[model samples]
Structures are given as structure tokens and as C-alpha cells.
Target: MAISKHIIITSLFISLLLLHPLVQAIDQEMTSNNRGGSSFAPKMNCGVACEARCRLSSRQNLCKRACGTCCSRCNCVPPGTSGNQELCPCYYTMTTHGGRRKCP
Candidate 1:
């Protein structure tokens, strides 16, 4: 009886150890799916939106470049030429290396 009890406990402990990685992989997959599977994220027209947002900037080329980068990453562009950042949280929170707002 003592030897059988030891075997049962050892088997259960080994099984749990083996199952840990499989459980972690399933959790990671669920997390990725919940974030909108990359292949299924809605595509946005970055060109038109960037153009519209950067239209009034004195540095048109720079504005377009920055806006395009932000839109591509966030898949969004806040409407209007300026000051409506509340519309897109992802776009609004991006920052440059200098710690200034990066999104146009």
C-alpha cells in the first residue's frame, strides 16, 4: 500500500508538469485571437487619411510620413487636420524618440 501511494503521487506530479507548457500555449493562442488575429485586422486607407490629416501642415512631406507610419501601426487616423486625438486612443498615445507626440 505504501509503495502504491508513492507511485500514484509521482504519476500525478509528472502529469501536471508535462501539462504546464500545453496549458501556457493554449492561453497564448487565446490572447492572440482576442487581440484580433493579425490576418483579420481591418485594413485602412492610410494614404487618403494621411493626406487629409497632413494637408495643413507647413512641413507637408514630414507630416505625411509621420501620419502614414502611425496609421499603419494603429490601423487608424483621428479625423481632422489637428486636435481631435480623442477619437483614436492608439494613434493618440504614440510618441517620438524625443518624447513628443508622434502621430499627426
Candidate 2:
């Protein structure tokens, strides 16, 4: 009887130990879902957007730099080579200290 009690207790202890990680994983998943899926920011392909916007610029390097900055901040870039700022209001509204449009 003594040995049987020890076996039962050990079995329960091992089962609980094995289940601990599973419980934690489920809890983490629930928390992440509650907070809107994953905690990481949504990936944006800035290279493609920058290329499209900056291709027409005489200073291609500077165009890319400015476009990248706006893209990172707004998480968006207006479509086309130029003149579609209406598509992205945030990108459109951003301006330089000199009162010029900051985004490409």
C-alpha cells in the first residue's frame, strides 16, 4: 500500500511537470490573440514602393532616402511614380520644415 501510494503520487507529479509547458504555451497564445494577433509589426516591402516612387527623381539616392523615411513612419507609400498623395493621407499630409511635401 505504501509503495502504491508513492507510485500514484510520482505519476501525478510527472504528469503535472510535462503539462506545465503546454499550459504556458496556450496561455501565451490566448494573450497574443486578445492583443490582436502577433506583437510584431506587420511587414511592409519598402524597397518596391521606394523604387516605384523614386525612379523619376534626378537624385535617385536622395529620393530613396526620403521615401524610405516616410514609408517607415506612415507604413505606406502613395501608388505611381508621382502625384498620388491622395491615396495615402498620412504620407500626403507630412511636410518639411520649409512647408514642402516631405514624401515622394
Candidate 3:
């Protein structure tokens, strides 16, 4: 009888442990859906400085700096332009150095 009680208690504890992660996952999903997915992105209102910050890593910032330099030196903008503003060429600037070149 004592063994059976111990087994039942252990089973309940194990089930709760397994379900805890699932419950947390559901809560996180709900919160993300309520918010705008992720808060990691930089606020657009900050303008140029913030734009440079978003491309934080050395390589990524390199591309950005290149764009700015290229624009000034050539006095010609890339394909996309909103009047005088230079557009982000890469899809997402890459911080990882060894990966393929970033998308524009």
C-alpha cells in the first residue's frame, strides 16, 4: 500500500514537471501575440544614430558606413531612394562574420 502511494505521488510530480514547460510556452505565445511579436527592434523615430546602432556589429556597421561613404563620394544613391535618404540595402545586417554577405 505504501509503495502504491509513493508511485502515485511520484507520477503526479512527474506530470506536473512535464506540463510546466508547456504552460509557460503557452503564456509566452499569448504575450508575444498581444505585443508586437518581439521588442528587440530599434525604434524608427530615433533617425540616423539609431539606424547605425541597429547595425551594431563591426561587419554590419561596415556595410552601413560603406553605404554612407559611397553615397557621399559618388553623389549617387543606390537603387532605392526616398528623395535624399539612403535605404537599407541588406534584409538584415549580419553580425556573424563568417556567413554569406548580407542582403540589401
Predicted model with the maximum lDDT: 1
Query: Which candidate number has the best TM-score?
Result: 1
lDDT of 2 by residue, 1-104 (tens): 99999999999999999999999999998888768623455757888889989998999999999999999888889888888889878899999999999898
Q: Candidate 2: which pairs clash?
A: none
Greater TM-score among 2 and 3 belongs to 2
Stretches of candidate 1 exceeding 4 Å from the true structure = 1-39
Rank all candidate structures by their TM-score, best first, as comma-separated numbers: 1, 2, 3
User: TM-score of predicted model 2?
Assistant: 0.59
Alpha carbon lDDT at 57, candidate 3: 47
Per-residue C-alpha lDDT of model 1 across residues 5-82, encoded as one tens digit per residue: 999999999999999999999999988986974667778999999999999999999999999999999888998899
Candidate 3 off by > 4 Å: 37-104
**Candidate 1 Cα deviation (angstroms), residue 19:** 14
State every prediction's TM-score relative to the real structure: 0.64, 0.59, 0.35
RMSD of each: 5.0, 5.7, 12.9
Q: For model 3, how does the per-residue alpha-carbon lDDT over 19-78 read when each residue is reduced to its tens digit?
A: 999999999988886685235443333235434443544565655564554433333333
